[model samples]
Structure formats: structure tokens, C-alpha cells
Target: MNRKNGITVCIIAIIAVVLIYAQSGISFGDPVYQDMDQYFLLNGQVQTGGNNICTDVVFDFRAFDTLGEATVLFTAVMGVIVIFRRLMKGEEYEAE
Candidate 1:
């Protein structure tokens, strides 16, 4: 490798190592800010009137997000249908 490429790779490796080491305090399956979970577990059923916490979280607290996802998926499907409508109209796809 060229000297310039080697220097760039070394800088990148150092930066990556520093960044990873800096954030090594973060752990999976346990978080720092977790009051929201306790709130949900305690009051999800009472406030949202859902017997299931999973359903309550998905449908009550995150309804707008779920709706947005459904909207995006519907729009994508509609777009694909529009694009392929020509083939649906008595047309044949041929391999060249």
C-alpha cells in the first residue's frame, strides 16, 4: 500500500478504537433511562385499558408510529402495483 493510504488506514483504525473504547460503558439488555418501562408496566393497563402490555405499548403509546409505518407500507405497495399494472393488462414478460 502507498504511504498516504497506510497513514489514512492507521488514522481510521485509531479513531475507531477510540470511539469504541469511549462507548464501552454502554451495555445491552440494561439501560440508563428506564423509568418509561416501569411506567408502562404499572399504568399501561389502567390508562390504555389494554389487558396486554405488549398490545398496549404497540397500539396505545406508539399508535402514531404504527399508523405511519402502515401508511408507508401501503404507499409502497400501491407504488409497486402502479408500476406493474402494465404487465397486468394482458401483457407478456419475455426474457431477452
Candidate 2:
């Protein structure tokens, strides 16, 4: 077989192995760790003083994580704009 076909076969084999391993190791409806979930459910409202548990977790428990995600998203958008702006600089546009 050619190099490209060999590479494709290797990739497909890797993906199939990963899928089989994941399916065998993970249970669909049941989860292994419940201690953290129980703790959050019991004390999330008292600690964060938020009526919504989801918001409390996101804003209070994982504030830094959320901020980091937002910063990453903003940086990506700015990078895209800069790249496109540079590419479009040579193009001519009609007056609107």
C-alpha cells in the first residue's frame, strides 16, 4: 500500500481502539464519583448565596476557569480579525 493509505489505516485503527476502550470502561447511565456532586448540591447555595446552582458553580466555584475561557475566545477572535484585515488590505472596495 502507498504511504497515504497506510497513514489512513493507522488513523482508523487508533480511533477504533479508542472508541472500544471508552465504551468498555465507561458506564452509560451510572457515574463513578458522586462525593463531589453531593457536596456541591448540599452546600453550593449556602456558600455562593446564588439561587441558581449552575450559575453558582460557574461564577463562584470556577470563576478563574470561566475568565480564562473568555480571554482565550477574545484572543482567538482578535487574531482572526487581524489575519483577515491584513489579507484584505490589497483588495479594492466600491463606495457604499
Candidate 3:
């Protein structure tokens, strides 16, 4: 095989091995990490001012995660807008 084909095959084999090892550690259809869930369910309302457990967990306990997701989304949107901005700003065509 050519160098490129050999390299591609090696890379794919490596990725497959890594994925197999990673999947072996996870217990699908089973609650492996229930302590955190139990703690949140028991204390979410008490720790947060909101009486609603779901709201408290999302808005208070996991607010930083939500904020990070929002920030990433905003950044991606801004990047797309920036890339397409020149066309909208009357720079779609120019005379040589």
C-alpha cells in the first residue's frame, strides 16, 4: 500500500481501538453514578432558593454549565456572522 493509505488505515485502527477501550468502561442501561444524582435531588431545593427541584438544579446548581453552553453558541454564531458580514456590508463585488 501507498504511504497515505497505510497512514489512513493505521489512524482508523487506532481510533477503533481507542473507542473499544473507552466503551468497555461505560455501563449502559445502568446507573453507575447515582450519588451525585441523589445529592442533587435531595438538596437542590434546599440549597437553591427555588422550590422547584428541576429549576433549582438547572438554574442554580448547573448554571455554570448552561452559561458555558450559551457562550459557546454565541461565539459560533458571531464567527459565522463575521465570515458572512462582508457580503451583507455591500462588499459582495468590486471593480478591478
Candidate 4:
């Protein structure tokens, strides 16, 4: 198919998927305070021993998950920088 038709099909598919996802009601992240209980059970308390359950869950039990999430954010930023750099380099090469 031509470029325009391919782009139109992709956009339609993306919109359909997004609509389905929105209707599914599945949530990401801490939905409620009770969600912390599972984390507490899996990971033992240390510095979070006497702290509130939610705090313990957030700072202690899910520490690595949080760290990985932060790493992902950092990676995305770096990726954006690399992408922009490549674009700029291409422009410079074209200019030269």
C-alpha cells in the first residue's frame, strides 16, 4: 500500500486499541492502600518496620521497582537526546 494509506490504517488501529484499553478499566500503579499488603508480605520490613504500611510499601518493598522506573525515565530522556542528535547530525550532513 501507499504511505498515506499505511499511515491511515496505523492511526485507525491505534485509536481502536486505545478505546478498548480505556473501556477495560484496568488500572496501573497503586490503586489503593490495601495494595501495599502484598508488597509488605513479599519484602520484609527494615527501615520501614514501624512506618505506615503505605509508606513501607512505597519506599521499602517496592524500592527496586521504583528505581527501575526511574532508570526507565532516564533511559527515555537519553534516547530522546540520541534521536535529536541523529536528526541534527543528518541536517548538518545535508548542509555540508
Q: Which predicted model would earn the best lDDT?
A: 1
In angstroms, give how far residue 47 of model 1 lies from its true place.
2.6
When sorted by TM-score, best at the front, the candidate numbers are: 1, 2, 3, 4
Q: What C-alpha lDDT values do all the predictions have? A: 0.90, 0.87, 0.84, 0.73
TM-score for all predictions? Answer: 0.65, 0.64, 0.55, 0.39
Candidate 3's C-alpha runs over 4 A off are 45-56, 89-96
* TM-score, candidate number 3: 0.55
Considering only N, C-alpha and C atoms within 3 Å, which residue pairs clash in candidate 2? Answer: none
What tens digits encode model 4's per-residue C-alpha lDDT throughout 20-54?
98867956764556655565655545545744767
Tell me model 2's lDDT, rounded to 2 decimals: 0.87
Lowest-scoring 10 consecutive residues by lDDT in candidate 1?
87-96
TM-score winner between 1 and 2, please give it.
Answer: 1
Q: Rank the candidates by lDDT, best first.
A: 1, 2, 3, 4
Model 4 misplaced stretches (Cα beyond 4 Å) = 1-52, 86-96
lDDT of 3 by residue, 1-96 (tens): 999999999999999999999999888878877998789888877788677887787778889988998899999998997787776866653434
Candidate 2, 1-96: lDDT as tens digits:
999999999999999999998899888878789888787889998998988988888988989999999999999997897677757768753335
lDDT tens string, model 1, 1-96? 999999999999999999999889889789789999999999998999988999998888999988998999999998997788776868774434
Evaluated with TM-score, which candidate comes out highest?
1
**Model 4: per-residue Cα lDDT at residue 94:** 41
